[model samples]
Target: MSYPFGCIVVGSGHAGCCAALSAVEAGCQRVLVVEKGPKEWAGGNGYFTAGAHRTVHGGLRDLLPIVQNVTPAAVATIDMEPYSSEAFTTDIMRLGGGKSDPEMVSAVVGGSRDAVKWLAEWVHVPFILSFNRQAYLVNGRQKFWGGMVLSVEGGGKGLIAAHQQALEREGVDVWYETPAVELILEDGHVTGVVVLRNGQRIWLRASAVILACGGFESSPELRAKHLGSDWSRAKVRGTPYNTGDGLLLAQFAGAQLTGDFAHCHSTCWDANAPDDRGDRELSNQFTKSGYPLGLMLNAQGHRFVDEGEDFRNYTYAKFGREILHQPGGYAFQVWDSQTIKWLREEEYGDDVVKKIWANDVAQLADNLISEGLEDREAFINTIAAYNAAVQASQRERREVRWDPAIKDGLSTQSSQQFLALPKSNWALTLEQQPFLAVKVACGITFTFGGLAIDPETAGVISASSGEPIPGLFCAGELTGGIFFGNYPGGSGLTAGAVFGRKAGREAAKLAEDIYN
Candidate 1:
């Protein structure tokens, strides 16, 4: 421990693990990883994730070899469309509203497939086809929609366990409860880190330091300062350990800030969940994305956004803000028996969230009134009007079917008429018996602002000089400009892998050159 290490990585999340692993792979010896949280709270935002990792692939055939869950027999029963680099790039640009850095987006999109492969093959992250979250059985085949199709086995916990095993195998020493206080710079170059452990300050000298400690989403002060006053009300969907330490470290080192600081990725979390932080046991189960299968109503008994504007993965992030803007900063997702079964059990099962049940529309509204539905009559009228619109649209299409696996064109609008707030697709009547509703609030996942980084080496860019800072690199949520307002689902982890590897490999090369 007395000798100067080759590289030091901050944070112990998936990105940190990837960085440390890559540094070792690039022939760096004695790499150290320092984490802010205790050993029990290891994985940062990654542990709270569903472990879904989006990447470009050539359909089922290309994915079969990497995934462990799908059997040979099951392969024939799967329908997965190939996701090309072009499609991945377009998704990032489109979701980010054309504000994303095209070069950074290219770096991620281009490396996505290789990153996934390395995670599975090298890191031993058990990859699986996301049947529960991303696929639905249609015509006796599991149809994968959206651009997301892969996930780590057993979700986030499994993902972290795999990384831990990999790190141990690579002989990397990870220090838990060692919160990095500041970056140490000498002659305008980052040389090491100052961390506090058990209230004692200690300096660790290394040739290169990589910041992978995530964003400022958990800090309400930072959230309000950047994302506006109302964003403080959004629930912290991941680890409370992030708290902007990486941002501060970079800022103090004169690193340039980039991306939209005012926006973030969020989702519809269960209203009954703890206000300040996410539950470790429930993890991502607190999400209530069933709106795509039914309707989302506010306290005023009115449908707000189009529920089926796109696949759930594409629309879920931005919709959380819409829910937060609703009356009382919450809303309700309602579904009848027909589409109720379509809701992911992990999210809507009785154990996950409170389910209000009623046999008829009026009774349903009456029941929801207790849960903050303001107008029972308006709620009933809304359902009645929605049902009427669906019937009218159905009549216009004749034999149109409801398919959750595709954009089946079963919307609440016909060629000649439309509802004021139309369900774009998967439109179904809410007249079936045993209607159910679940209360939901906004859950802030991660922020989109951090230090601007060099696309190839993941080096933090200097604010004053507009050049890469010597010995300073970054990855994961701590690095910015690949995203702006929003990002495609599963892209977060992929971007982490893409840039984390770059940061680690390049940091090792710098370390070798300096120490030699």
Candidate 2:
């Protein structure tokens, strides 16, 4: 069947869903969302997300002083800490290596609160306020896809189900398992798409086409081509459907890709294993198990970054960036039993002990030995040395020598707090009964760089001339450099909502102006 849509949105992931919904809401009469996978199947990197959307608005100023004054007492609530807009922007820009587009960054940072409000208030999606009840965090509040499966309820099949329902209500048609193979262009204008479905090729016409199919994380060939040998063998933690289909199609149509050098959650699972469940089990284990945050080390056993820092910040540091270039693109999470126990207890609760393979030092050593991931003697010595420093620091009433990194930054009160904790490096002590070591590899969720677009309209720009590609729009992961290089906590979903709405609304308006 030759299906004609006023606007065709490719890929049914977060960006695609948001784009379609926003397009219909913007008054597009006949909209179509082309999904390459089945409705029940997970699409894009949205499913693997922890669902924390970071914004700088809200009562950030009021909460910053509280966080700064009480962070030591509230370290357990790091996930819930409220950051000011200035702090968030500063950290993001610093993390981006000063390469982020200021205009786009401002839009994303500025629109964050509104996006969160829309998701919570307008979409009726439930979100958890941080442990301190100051900011919002998404933790199992709804299914990964906002609980839209076969029904309108939030607990439905997946996000696509909910997005699809919203689209249908607004008169949008959805073609599942219908992959767009090629773009149909006429007179230097994008007019329609050639889609493959049911073992047959079909033509779907649209006034405008928006490519939101995501990045090339799952495509080894593309990774080799862009990311080089370092990431050639890296495993993916997101959806398998992100094979760069949209990217390839856009490139074929003369679109330029950016941020080929950027990726999300660089340290993930090793995908070389035959039975890789996309690292879901490992991620759950890491999140649920309360492994004390410390520095990661390479096979040669050297500290990379202050593991206590945020994961995203740690990944962009010089050492973490260099580790990605090393063999296996892997590192180890080294911590002691106490931290592990605390983490498991706090994050996973009673289920923490059950999920972890090793409980104490000996069991952990034995477990590492079985996995062939670490040497028992070296691991033991490392812990002993760390513990010795902890004891010495307590007696001396000074910071420990083992961790020079933390000492320089400690204030008087910070030093006192450090001394209070059994004179031990609570964040990185190896003195506990059972030493635990987990083999961690840089698992990239999706590439951050893709075709550049106007931040306001989500219109793809020409690579050579730096002009908008008329009749062509991009959203979600397909639009690169939106976050610059550093990803704000909740910016992924916020970007989808902000830019997706912008793109869809503008695309519909353009379509109506031309074809009405």
Candidate 3:
């Protein structure tokens, strides 16, 4: 079977939607976006996000265009620090362990603010302050922490909906339940894609093809093959449709794969959450990210990773992998009544959640005795020591004020007194009873590994040859080298918009040059 379009984009997530919309803006009359998932589940992992986009902003004035309901008085009460392009790029390079491609990092970081502006001004995607994840209250005034500030009004679903509306407004054709299976190359250049649509194999010929599909985190076989055998137990946090189709398709096109294949963007999710993606009611509840406010203990009642090493946005992605490495692939996020108000409402209010609480740390340990908890004495002693250390650290730093908006330098000082892993920041005393615990497990978001593409144009480059594949572009999670094991929160959405728009415009130009 055969069909024709001016430009064809694989997948219908944020990347594909942006690619299709931009293609139309670049003079493509007929742009087709193909997705394997059904209409309700078309947006891929992007629809499952918090709608946050990490971008470089020059304080309150720079963010005013996107952030809704921002008054001069409200802005005056908050501290809006500038996140510069250099700082953005440096953060990526640093967090990625210096393995991020400098060129790709530069392109994404340099274009992020403009890309976000485009989304708000041109696409009309409503943006709001990320009060839950990126900001903290200090002195009765809201202060933004981390480099991120804005998110779509309704998060991932809202972001996808806005992009979908824009695509529809541009008259871009969308083919749902059509999964791109193969790339047809002629004279070493991409000409079209072969996809499965309605149980029929159809060859959709186009002047250009943009692969905006995702990575292979959903496939256990691929996870074991690339990310090590331990990833086999990793529960998927998004759609089950992202089974490495895009990565495999790009690889078959001779694209060089890069980034940390053995690592992914993972997080602590409800341990009893479904193996597949959660529904709208669950939303981002699959996440249990407020661990920094309290404690995380393994089955043996021991702290492993540094919960307060940094902000949750900076550390949440990699911590799930650590939880998966623990015995029985489970950990519990423990907190007290005093810090419970700070927990993200999405997580604490989850219907599937089972809260375990007790009056004391020892009683809390006993509550989990039936769930393979062993060391009651150790658990009691650990909390007692942690509490004492917090009191001591507060006294030692008597001149230093405690602030939740930033790293207050208030840490548990007893880690040196014992051999347990230390809480490096925001270590408040867990003495305020009753104690609480929420069982959590590893939930994988997306794989960090993908094909390499041209930094400026988002054109896929051939591995065998050091040249771009003509009429071939790539973006979103399918493009590699920008992220390693760790990524700054909200940057994924920004990357999708920046590179997806670039790929669309470049592919449209290529199509015009060839077929016009």
Candidate 4:
């Protein structure tokens, strides 16, 4: 039986889910959610996320005062204190290399606190509380990525399930295992969707359509064609379902696209190689031995950017650069037995950090030699020189670490903490045995660039004239330029939620007001 709906939301990920929820809440009587995968594989980027959700006001607004009082020296304080909105904005702009749009950034920053509060109060999600009895904010003031997940209890699964239940409660129809093959357009407005269900093409009618499909990290051709060659070389860490189908469909319908040059979390595992099992084995090695925990070198044995910066900077640093030119694009973590012991103790309970291998310098060297990933003598010599530099710098009170160039070719902070160790002590030293070197190939989770949209309503805009396409909307990674070059914490999910809600509510209003 064919079905008609007031609105059709493609992709049941965080964006689509939020859009449906908002539509139902806004008094839409008929809404359908079409998801490509089954319930077991429902989550898009929201599932694998580290769960950091940063917002500027509302529940997270209390962090603004703390960030305001922090000095440059205090930025290094690792008490996991809350940060301020101004400081968070500054960091986001810096990370984006000042290419961010002020209006969009301000909108995200301004809406963040309210969004988090809504998620907790209305959505029944439980936010992580701070030691001082407030919601846990990153650096003490801003919301962390995983905060939303903690608020929901069962993490991404819980959040998704809750939304699904809400949709069902509102009588929203959800079609699982139904992938939208194309957008049905009539007279230049989206009329419905042509989906593949049970090996049959089903034409689902809707007054309006919302595209919440994710980015194209899973498609090498899209990456090579849309993004530059450097981004194409990186590995994918997100879901394999994002093959640019929604993007292609929208573009085919004459929708304008933007933000083809943005990406997030460039660090990836060499899971492409048959020899590598996954990130787990490598993580276990890193935790046990404390190796491969410092600055990365290219294949040529020279240090790249500062290893202590966020992984985003590290990923951009390696793009198009010769791995050999920068210390072979992979380097060893040289630490003594004390450091190794400390790391094991510190990271013992954490599953995320347990992937690192902690080993003495010499032992690490031998491990690499045995693995045939490096030459024994050169590896040893490199560690020795690194140790010498670290020692000399410590004595002279000078920064001796190698800092990689980030976007716009600016060097990151020289002194940053990593592996729960001070930057200075984290430097390579030759005195330690079991020196560890793990070959790391640059990896990326997802590309952030996609179609441009109106900041106020999440309506797709014409790339050539910057005008809105009525009756058409986009959310999630499909809507680009929202994050600029770098993303504000939780902007991905937050944008999806905020904009998806707007699109759904607005689309429903437009549908209800349509003249016969």
Report every candidate's CA lDDT.
0.91, 0.57, 0.85, 0.56
TM-score of each: 0.98, 0.78, 0.97, 0.75
User: Which window of ten consecutive residues has the lowest lDDT sum in model 1?
Assistant: 1-10
- In candidate 4, residue 54 scores what lDDT? 58
The total of clashing pairs for model 4 equals 69
Poorest stretch of ten by lDDT in candidate 3: 412-421
Most accurate candidate by TM-score: 1
Ranking by lDDT: 1, 3, 2, 4
Residue 289 displacement in candidate 2 (angstroms): 8.3
List the candidate 3 regions with Cα displacement exceeding 4 Å.
350-352, 414-420
User: What is the per-residue lDDT of model 4 for residues 229-332, given as tens digits with 9 covering 90 to 100?
Assistant: 65555555455677787778888778787663545434423322222112322321121112323444333334444443342321232332233123323333
Model 2 per-residue lDDT tens digits across residues 452-474:
88877888877776877777889
lDDT of 1 at 58: 91
- Most accurate candidate by lDDT: 1
Candidate 1: clashing residue pairs, number? 0
Could you tell me the TM-score of candidate 1? 0.98
